[model samples]
Target: MAVPETNKVMRLLEGRHWELREGPFKRLGEGADQRLREIADNTSLTNYLRFRALIALSLYDNEETGVHLERHARSGIRPLPAEGFHP
Candidate 1:
């Protein structure tokens, strides 16, 4: 079973309140970037949650996050990594 905190993080990631305000590759501002980074670095979160965080970061044009997602995909994980997703 997933931990409560991890569930909460996942919920937050999917929640409308935190939805990306712009198109992919658009900057989400510093606050949003920091929040995504926080979620990405949180070891307590499930890999799925971490993946979502990385996706969110990618939408903000974070290249490093895209690379991390690619690595996860190469490892053959679920939710399969996105391809050709620059930004």
Candidate 2:
């Protein structure tokens, strides 16, 4: 997705203004982890999206997600574009 569109989604997610009709994990089941892994692994995506996916995985509180989050934290990678919002 384009940066603007991705940013819009991020805002909705972060703002808690959007509700999942079906919980993502429930809807995707085991595939949720796979999808998160794919998003986390894809370097082409904005850091905001990748980080958000990582955070979502962490929220699931699974061992794998914890490991991934730990690795990501240790990497010290900063989000691209620096700032997420503009007035």
Winning candidate number (lDDT): 2
Cα misplacement distance, residue 67 of candidate 2 (Å): 0.7
- Candidate 2 lands at a TM-score of 0.56
Worst lDDT 10-window in candidate 1: 78-87
Q: Which stretches of candidate 2 lie over 4 Å from their true place?
A: 1-22, 79-87
Per-residue lDDT tens digits of candidate 2, residues 50-76?
656665665456787777767777876
Per-residue lDDT of candidate 1, residues 1-87 (tens digit)? 222343343455664345543443233324555566677766676555565677666555556556655665676544423432222
Each prediction's TM-score versus the true structure: 0.42, 0.56
Number of colliding residue pairs in model 2: 0
